[model samples]
Target: AAAVAGMRDNNAILSSRDWARRDVLMQTKCAPLPREEGRPAPRPLNLVQAATVASHAWPPQSTCETLGLTALCDTVRSVAVNREVIAAVSNKNIFHMLQLYVNGIKAAGIKNSMVVALDDETAAWLKVRDVANYVKVLRSRTGDTGNHATSGLKFKVLIDFLSVGCSV
Candidate 1:
């Protein structure tokens, strides 16, 4: 497909030897600042510290809350065609959103599609673009909005859709 070819071409350019050398040169020129007088020197984590951190649970068992189950059911029902809903899960990455809108959704002429925004910014972006009807903002119960935490909330959204009698 044309998209696949374009992606391959972009990857080839990014992984070229010249780009690698330039990346290394930029990193060397932008090295971190020296330690301040009273501040401890920066160092990699010790084995014990690394192990302790790694052993802890990540993204903290969180739940997602939307406007309400009734609202979700309404949105799903409005977008569904024969009980099938097309859903796209996204965070605040606008570039990817544009690509999906243009190449995937728009190109396919999909009317049964909706976007599940994992954060407030993404929800606002979708609304501003006149896609508010297709956007659902899923907020984390634990109040963590980091990328990993938001990603972990996607399963809950999918389950919600299925519970509303719509297949995504």
Candidate 2:
């Protein structure tokens, strides 16, 4: 009850529609007006300011380039199942996107038998397979008695210290 009263006191309970309308109005003011033909073109606005030029049609190519996706896309495309990371992405046309990823992976020389295809799950898992090899290396390092001062350190103070540091 007190929280509700405080919100009313501060006029903090604005509707999303009202907020969106206000944002659009603010952006419209920042846009440049038409000028005479003889004048030099206006200087480019910074990326944030450029967004105001077309509030309804923002998130343009420049925005994606600004975020370093141009370089990232090439590398991530080899491993990424879809346009984005598998765990955090969704698609309106999931079937089409999945087909694209599968085709891309297949074209990259991955065997069809190696790729897993399920109704709700599909992945090449090449990188994931490499990661499993890394896990094997890590396990070997921990068990390598030749390098360690003692044969077993599970009960040692150094192991406790390492575990504590890891938790932090």
Candidate 3:
């Protein structure tokens, strides 16, 4: 991605006919310059470093790698859990990561029901259930509120997915 961004930037510079900037670009080790009839030989650059700098350029445009990942990630985005929530849980121990995951869900406005199915009666029942008490304790210990423990009932898409299953 970085390399591609650099290549684009270099192309931009070339299109502008900024020959005076060529020395500055060379010092900064951007992409290889096109051969000019009277110009000296162009030197090789560390594309890896150039790429890192290119990623931070203003008015960023999507590259093939980013588009490819987006295409592949559509399936993952369709999952029940938020990717950020999953990332918190998967990257750390479940016990330690639970708070972060809960916080992420809350921050993203993802309802609990979106994570798993549960009606009001079931949610109420689960609140008192032994397993649920453990979650309550975990929440209390982690300084979280009831919001993290209850089911999310408002995500119509999740409901649709549940009702329609693979057909969705």
Best candidate (score: TM-score):
1
Best by lDDT: 1
Winner on TM-score (1 vs 3): 1
Q: After superposition, how far is residue 74 of candidate 1 from its true place, in Å?
A: 2.3
Clashes of each: 0, 0, 3
The TM-score of candidate 2 is: 0.16
**Tens-digit lDDT track of model 1 for 1-168:** 122212333235453444433443344443333444687766643331122322222111121133246656556556665556677677775546455673556444566777777667777777776552335566677877666777777788876765444567
TM-score quality measure for candidate 1 = 0.48
Model 2, CA-based lDDT: 0.30
Report the C-alpha lDDT of model 2 over 1-168, residue by residue, as the tens digit. Answer: 223212232225666664433443344432333554687887743332333434333333364365433322233333332122221121222546545654544444432112222112222233433310000111223544232322232223222212211110
Candidate lDDT scores, in order, read 0.55, 0.30, 0.31
Residue-wise C-alpha lDDT for candidate 3, range 1-168, written one tens digit per residue: 133323434344354655655445445443344565676776643231133323223112243134333321333334323122121111111323444545445454443222221333333433343111111112233443344432222243232232221112
Q: Cα RMSD for candidate 1?
A: 17.5
Candidate 1 deviant stretches above 4 angstroms: 1-67, 98-103, 132-148
Q: After superposition, how far is residue 6 of candidate 3 from its true place, in Å?
A: 22
Q: Model 3: clashing residue pairs?
A: 112-152, 113-151, 113-152
Between candidates 1 and 3, the one scoring higher on lDDT is 1
